[model samples]
Target: MAALDEIQTIVILMQENRSFDHMLGHLSLEGLLPDVDGLRQEDMELTTYANEYRNRFYWPFLIQDEASVIRDPPHSRHLVQVQMARSSSGKKFRMSGFVDSYIQYTQHQTEHPPPMGYFDSRGAWMTSFLARQYCVCDRWFTPLPSDTQPNRCMAFTGTTLIDDTDSRLIPHREHVFDWLNARGVRWRVYHDGPPFFLLFGRFHELVGMKYRPFSELAHDIQHEDPGQAPQVIFLEPRYFDFFWSDEPANCNHPLALVCHGERLLHRVYTALTCNPEKWARTLFIHTYDEHGGFFDHVPPLPIENPPPPGADFTEGFKTTGPRVPGLLVSPWVQPGKAFHGNLDHTSMLQLLAEKFGSGPEDYSASVNHRRAQRIRSLSEALADAPALRPIPTRAPEPCPPMPSMKRQPRAPNERAFQKAALELLQHEGPIATAAKYPDLVGAPLTP
Candidate 1:
């Protein structure tokens, strides 16, 4: 409780589409984070962790050169189900369908598979460094075994109406921003390009003040009156859709150079540490939206929660999605800690309620229900023990130049982002939007 009060600011940076085993599994395999529930030597050498496709068995292999040549893996609801391929007993997943699912969806029977590839410490330098230096929530999972839209909706709105990505504004009973505003919580969003929240209604009005570009984050952290600074801030990376005409995909979505997201992590950390007093009181969290169809040996936990009243998926979510990487950064956090608590995205809202509202249940009854079912708050990541006083700050090697494509691709999520950018431009007028978010200038207006 004291840790929550001493910390005056909480910043969240949620990247896209990478999974726990694919990104950080190698951490344990390489002896860096030996305690983490990551890849093991046996998993790589034996058939126990192998996935069978056709007559061939595949094990996790090192993805070298930052894996720029790797293609996006299929992560839709049905495909994810295929990837799980639960054992006959229905109590566990064989996790053997990943290679098959990839070949089936992409029709790349002869091509090198991407889902079984994993990155080592040097490959995922930024994430590994933070994990080694602070606390890593090893058991955190995405709320559903699906793709971006539904999991993200679960993160921000406590519930989702759809189970897959669609090219439209996400319908939510209430947005987190509305909840924050009603309770008078000061919050802000900083984006490298177009803010992801534009997918929700009222994005235009929010863009100018509540939603600002990445450029202003450092300034606000260093120069703004300490009391006037936002209590919470969300940092949105350059999504994959923006890189066709803009910068590299910094959110680490499939097909993106993972280094871009690493570089983004460096930038946000640097900005926060640039202000020592603020840094002392700030808590920065880093996590991914979903697994992006990567291979994970762990099966989803069975925690049944009925879907929203009008959800497209009539049946509620039966289990949590595959694990995603989660990091907790704060001066109050014990260094070299690995928290194994069972947590999900809704835990963030519960943390907020503990800090600002009545108690654990103040976030919402839905979130409180999940709490009753054993979902924990971020507060657990904060330590009451002595902490690292002088926060280490060393910049990492620059990422390689992003690979180029001949033309824009036709991913549905990309089109949805394009639509959101267009709606923002239409609502605020190009001139005003340009002044507010210069990065959205060339955002595609059509699918």
Candidate 2:
């Protein structure tokens, strides 16, 4: 085993949506994802409680409630209702997609339906990511009943909801950052829009350990070339720009998501390779914040893990949800090994804390339950000194080069841009919109 003292840096990349099966189910099998399986699209499908037909398609083993079909929380009712409204009112798809349709459908708890484009075949991406990097804990899970915000907070702090009303509410629990500060480990979060502080306030000390917009990161990697990158870097995909998709862009947009993810990893690989002295000990991790309502056959058992309950939100908080997928890329991890050990969000935080010698109290400590097992460094996976492999580094792609920008244009005569836009949009279509305004662009152009 490589000595722990040899490790110096850790980098984390957390994307949105996608469950394990939705993204990695058939990965182990060749030509399976492309094969047909009756009405089941040869691919994975999200389960729903409202529809018996939909729920029947998932892994029967994972599901426990026969009548209460599993539906991804934050349902899609608002989305469907809005679409029906536009059809009868002789209106086009609304540009105010967030309020009218998209967000509502994505944010509610409804029955399972066919795989939305965003979730088409994320398994391909997950499999590829694991085969190319490292796979840990197949049973890894999320820590909340909600989506991105809460799950993300749990990841960083191993706690429950930050705010019952607003996910933006930052938790005060001591996190991995606290340990880093004491140990003098440096870090930062590269974003694309507002600083994380705006949404997370006082937690800035933890989040801001290193904070910069995605664009800023691009500039630094290409131009500034900071002699030393942050010890721990969190790279968030540019929401609309890099992860764009038509069907409300859930989590499955593998072409865009995987492409962007690979490109980003390539950069990290490059940074490490260019400066072997620094990269040799660095570890890069790429994973999802939560599974957007896609299908998963594996029923998630409620693990006894608890975060600093109510420490972030209401007192007595507990994690109640399913698993999310993750990829660990480093010399220390067993390359291409799929760890099927049962785990939850706290499990990951627990592993990281232990790897860096961060006290358990900083993470799993405040929580109550079976303490998650820490993952040991995977340095032995490499034959020689843990050096960054000489791999090709694809740089940050330009706007025009992005698949989202290459969407086919609407027919010249199509009215109600929504009709035109919706028609033009698909699972992996390009993201081309003449209309720059979010509201005006997607609304029906017709009267």
User: Listing every candidate in turn, what is its Cα RMSD in Å to the true structure after a full C-alpha superposition?
Assistant: 1.7, 13.1
- lDDT per residue for candidate 1 within 359-413, as digits (tens), equals 7689887787788888899888788853856888767767778656425657777
On TM-score, the candidate that comes out on top is 1
Measured by TM-score, how close is model 2 to the native structure?
Answer: 0.59
lDDT, model 1? 0.83
| Residue 401, model 1, lDDT | 81
How do all models score by TM-score?
0.96, 0.59
Off by over 4 Å in 2: 1-3, 31-51, 54-130, 161-168, 195-197, 203-209, 213-229, 240-274, 305-320, 358-364, 367-447
Stretches of candidate 1 above 4 Å error? 67-69, 110-112, 403-406
